[model samples]
Target chain A: MTSFNAALVRADTPQLTRVINGYPITYLDSGATSLPPRAVIEAMSRHYELHHANVHRSVFQTASEATEAYEGARLAIAKFINAPGGAEEIVFTKNCTESFNLLARSWGRVNLKQGDVVLLSEMEHHANIVPWFQLRDMLGFEVRFIPVTDDFRLDLSNIDELMKGVKLLSVTGMSNVLGTINPIKELSAIAHKHGALIAVDAAQSVAHSVTDVKDLDVDFMCFSAHKMLGPTGIGIFWTRKEILRDMPPFLGGGGMIADVSVDGYTPANGPTRFEAGTPPIAEAAGLGAAVTYLTGLGMANIAQHEHDLTGDALTRLELEFSGRIRVIGPRDMTNRGGVISIDVDGVHPHDVAQMLDQFGVCVRPGHHCAKPLMKRFGLNATARISYGPYSLVRDTDMLLEALHSAIGMFG
Target chain B: MAGLEDLYKEIIMDHYRSPRNRGELPTPPAVCTEGFNPLCGDQITVYIDVTDGVLKDIKITGQGCSISQSSSSLMSAAVKGKSLEQVQETIGTFKQLMTGHETALEDGGEPEKVDIRALGELAALQGVVKFPVRIKCAVLAWNTLSQALSELPS
Candidate 1:
């Protein structure tokens, strides 16, 4: 197995070399979107330079090459998640948000009905929650939330009770705001026990953990490529082959059909039915290279590295800013990733983030698109500092330094 | 390019630390309007007591960044006892201040001609124009106050 070295990873990422203000950039916002390495960028550039053509529509050499690259990306992503049905299960969308929308509009329209319950969690990002809510508005389904405990974990104490009428249990694999890595396997078991199919929003967890959809026993998984060291404009929604076959098309136009007539159109077989019009060919190439790069470095090693960084940073943040800064997420390293949300006393997150910016530390400040979770915690916003595979201890050190400066300025 | 000091002036921080006229002023007697910046979750509520075509009393309430809260506080102090026409002028000036002269001209107004001295301490928030995103935070209070004024029973 190749050893995971953050310095080597940083060297490969062109963004890491950037300087902000007068200081070297300390990027700790990877939970929002990860920095792509040179390999991913070069792969995309190469595709655009050489083989820029629409896939599946043309028989030309360049078009075929583009199709091969695009299909190869789907296979790589399928393998990355250990999808049981492989490439046939992977459907590319605009982003993770679109993936959830596709799942809700297509699968939900078919299966869910009036009085059917769709269970979600309070800590879920808006992408996972809003689509279901929108669909519920139309289909007249009841949407219930799994409460978050005071300790920043999903309150599974009443999971069995919550899953009663829950035809579908959709939750985040890891919270974007809380950095709480949820027990997907355990939840999947409970969901099945309650006769509910489970879908996971793996936008945060997939990059920081080794995702095996088979092992997790989840029926559906949605994640964005941008958050997982890939490019934007491409995301994956993976499900079992039987489920994909049964689910209807989400966006209906071009490329997604076998035959189109004046009367009606028959949807294409497999994942292509969901992918309408020209796909993100260059982005698919970038995602393919990202998959290769992550695989080469080893996901296990990256996970461990991020775990150590998170644990250390959490501990240091607690010790140093004991009364000043309160961590909004789980303090324990167990079942957590590198996303750290902190609320500084007597300081708004926007002000704190602005202060940190002066020190060249990039942190995200806001509700993190988790309004329900923010309300649950009675917090408008928190300044979140997240880590990536390329992050190092120095990044945390920079964050701490910036935090001290911010507090000093705001205090 | 502007530094932190430019955004968080001493007067602005003072207003944020000790916000003036902060509390509810009874909705029946005072019209309360809430302004929200969905981008950052910064919110401000403005309560205006209009007495015979004059804004007699104004109170600011809500939670937000320093710029927002301070802008609300400064705005409350500025327009507390002003005539309706004067309050309208203040709102227009503050909005122009946040958006800058380019937008003012784009809206078919005069050039960059907002009198800085007329804004008084509100001019402290002028630096917000440098950081485009925070302009919303600075103007949220003004927008809410404008709403409150419009809602005043004529």
Candidate 2:
């Protein structure tokens, strides 16, 4: 096993040095949003200070520079994801939620009809489920979900029936709450076997591990930059260029037109067709820097480091707290990322999180935008803590101490 | 730490541990109204039986955290057997207490002490103002009580 230099990674992240409540901040909520490194911040600031102009519209030097940075970020993301269709497939959106909306509105609206079905999983984030529900109201398509098994994996027992008549299967590559990494390749194979196009919500997965869209054979993939140590206002929506050419534009205004007349407007070709209005120029630069930084550290090494930390925490928590706290995700390192959801007996997650806050251990306590999944497990909420490249075992040690105090108070 | 102590006062924790008037009452004579904290998934249903402008019985049933459930438990006990006017006054005082705007009004129209004696045990929740995130948790039951009251007649 390759060892990781977590202290070196932490040195790059300025937020890791912050102290709260007289204790060094133990940021365990990276599953919710990763703290950006100084390099990402500097890159964004450089773009804004040196080259600040709207993309694809103006004829000046800064405009060309802005456009170059924007499109260059798309190329960076393409290489990061190993996107088979390359930079032409990348469309910038407000966030991952908007990217899902683009799929539901543009591709889904065009392909799906009244009798068609869009199969999703129980572990999908609300962003993946809600858009299809909204489209269902308009297009009259049926939406079905694959259930989760008791072992904290997607229950595919009835997948054959679930996939019958399904035109599209949209799922999360990794659960934001559970940290269960879904087998996208296997799921995509099944979806294709049933003549359905597969789309992956990579919001949680892309940051933690390597994501090769071509290898997974997913037709569409979307993720947010903020979750991946980048700026908040940017996300990437990648699809096959041929499919994007046929799909209608989701949002319309300037910068997405070929020719406009009193009669109508012809939409632009390729990724720019869906990207209307002024995009997040500085955010794109930040994302470009983020991918560069992640590549420098190496995605596989980051995953291995996180897995070791997560695996250690899991063992320590169960051994120390046994029968007192239950983990909501998988117990082992196999087929999982660093996201850990803990259910402390006889205490509400909010109260538990509040107690942890005193010790400067930041953890998210809520449904985590996956309400239906919460209902599946008879839980309203759980305390979710995840890892990024910079997260350390010492952070998890602080987290355990906090959890012990919280349990002593409430349990 | 002071904020945490003030938030989890013995009275509040006692109410949470052994809630008062926790279940539903017989209805038709009783009218129930529900309110939910959408963000945290705290749903509270207040059941009130008003006979001739007096609350005959008050009960609250819900699933929520300590603050919300305890607030509801304490409120149900406080509002029971009180007149409609007294219930309204308590709700107003509680809201003002949470917001820290105008605490209480003396008969002379001066912004003075709240006469915490009037609030009885519900005054234990006065420390909620310090914890901004918990104000709503402390007020979910009061909002439902207000809704339940408006459903009653003159």
Candidate 3:
């Protein structure tokens, strides 16, 4: 076990302790969206002030500079994820939801036949499930779900049974609700052995730990920038080079086209073909700066910090609450991330959340967009307290105190 | 200890612990409407049996936060025996109250006041106005009632 004795560094994050309701705020809802660092905000503001021009169009110096900055961001993202075959394999979309929709509309429409099976896990966010459901309704494909065990882990014991006729396996790298980290590399290997392509939704995992796409050998992966201390409206969809070359274009617009005529149209190749119009230039630049910030701090260091925090939170919660609270995910930090979903006896989740808010402590209460997983666990909802790099032990203490207050009120 | 009393007042907790009209109605010529708040996973199913221009009976069955469930129970008790016009009028007045308009109704010709306590146990939810996120939970049942009425012929 890693001891959590690190200093509560307040140098990097200036807005850590904003006042809410006449009290210092404790933000524990980073799983919903992360607060951006000063570097990312400044980078975005700098782009808007200068070097704001359309790329790949003009021969002027401004256009050239803008194009270099935009493509440089792409390369930075590629290296950030250790994407094989360089920057061209990265396609920028609105968010992870849009990225999954693009794949469903483009590659899935072309490759999935009438009887082909599209396998998904029960722990998927609605973004991952709904697009495939829409595709199934339109394209006549079969949708199947991988069952979860009693402890909220993926039931890998029945992997062969579920992978019999699966053509494409879309799984989450880490469950947003349970915080259980799935074995993406092992799952990818299994999918490949069964002659299926795997696409991992790394929305929760990419922010907390290091994700090397090439080493995992996943066919496709998508994640959003908002969850990673960057601005919203920007996410990455990384596909293998060969897969990118073979798939049809997702959206047709100004940039994705090579040449257009009344008779025929030619589409641009690789990532450009997927990006249709003027991209989110400032947001992408901000995401690039966010990657730089994370790299400087070292993702491994952040992961270790989060792991220690999660362990501390669990130990404190279990010790204090004893038989009152039940945590939903793995009890060990070795197999989990920094999210903790908890249910209190005889207390509704919303009531718990409301009590926490009275102390200026923010948390999320609901199914966390995993209704099927909630059904599997036989729970209506759970109150979740997640952490980030800016979180401190004081925040956890506030949460514990507020929870106790809530329980007393109910009692 | 700022416990459930802060959010769930005595009356609200009473309705939650033992909800009124909680069972499902037999499938009759009833109009059924479902309400869901995606943000909080609060859902409700309301059934209205309107016969001969009167709301014969109103029942709701679902699971959600205490505010939502108790509000539904109170809503069922308020409009069960009222006519269609009365139900619509009460709904409009309740909507105004929830949206910060018409905080108090006029009383006996003196603009002095009409207490919302006259609105029955539903008045217990006034505390929800302080918590905006829970406003939806308190109003979900009324919204379902409006939907059920809208589907009727008048």
Best by lDDT: 1
- When summed lDDT is taken over every stretch of 10 residues in candidate 1 chain A, the lowest stretch is A1-10
Which ranges of candidate 1 are over 4 A from the true structure? Answer: B102-113
lDDT of 3 by residue, B1-154 (tens): 2233556798888888889988777666788888888778888999989988888888888878888888899888888989988898778766655664323322222123227766766677766655656779889999988987887755
Question: Candidate 2, overall lDDT?
Answer: 0.89
Per-residue CA lDDT of candidate 1, range A151-177, in tens? 999999988888888999999999999
Which TM-score values does chain B get in all models?
0.90, 0.88, 0.84
Docking class of 1: high
- Lowest summed lDDT across 10 adjacent residues in model 3 chain A is found at A1-10
TM-score of chain A of each: 0.99, 0.98, 0.96
Better of 1 and 3 by lDDT: 1
Tens digit per residue, CA lDDT, model 1, B46-66: 888888988899888799999
Question: For model 3, how does the per-residue alpha-carbon lDDT over A214-285 read when each residue is reduced to its tens digit?
Answer: 899899999999898889999899998999998899888989988999998899888999999999988888
Evaluate fnat for each of the predicted models and list the values in order: 0.85, 0.31, 0.65
Check candidate 1 and list the clashing pairs: none
The candidate maximizing DockQ is 1
Clashing pairs in 3: A409-B3
